[model samples]
Target: MSKIFHPVSEQEALAELPRLRQRLTAKARHAHQYRGTEGKSLMAQAKRALRWHQLFVSINRRACQ
Candidate 1:
């Protein structure tokens, strides 16, 4: 599937920050609540997603500023 790209204005980024933060927190919590091999795999994925969201949030904050 092809993805569409668009610019996000400062206002939009600022607005999205809170929701992103919430998702980041949830991901962190999920990453911690697991055990065994399957849990390890799932936690790895969650950590990766958390890192991506963190980078996005930081970039958004910088752009907004």
Candidate 2:
């Protein structure tokens, strides 16, 4: 099966950003319709960044080992 691939480094982590933000914004807009507070959305973005960083770190570590 084919796996994830990115032509550029910044584009890699930003790949899901648009879709994730859309989904999150919709949910937040529907849930509370709050103004300027992006709790869930920000958390989602942070988690995505953390996961991507962890994945790269793991790949590098394994390659070194």
Candidate 3:
């Protein structure tokens, strides 16, 4: 089996950003709320939030180009 990677169009990427940002915000809130109380899950949520940040940068960079 193989996976295909398709870069989204600039307009599509721009449209998706707001949704991703909302997810990032939710993940950040989860991470913060569970901090200390749930170390493992908090770390996981934080990692996911970080990935969203990276994706935001990547998508924005591509859109700029």
Clashing pairs counted in every model: 0, 0, 0
lDDT by residue (1-65, candidate 2, tens digit) is: 01343223444445755776566566555644544657566656656866676576455444444
lDDT of 3 by residue, 8-59 (tens): 5566766776887777667666665564758566667666876876676576
Candidate 2 off by > 4 Å? 1-37
Lowest lDDT sum, 10 consecutive residues, model 2, at 1-10
User: What RMSD value applies to candidate 1?
Assistant: 5.4
- The per-model lDDT (C-alpha) reads 0.62, 0.55, 0.64
Candidate 3 global Cα RMSD: 5.3
Alpha-carbon RMSD to native, per candidate: 5.4, 7.6, 5.3
Best by lDDT: 3
Compared with the true structure, model 1 gives a TM-score of 0.46
lDDT of 2: 0.55
Error of 3 at 2 (Å): 14
Q: For model 2, give the RMSD to the true fold.
A: 7.6
lDDT of 1 by residue, 1-65 (tens): 01222345557766876786677667656765665576667657766876776566566555545
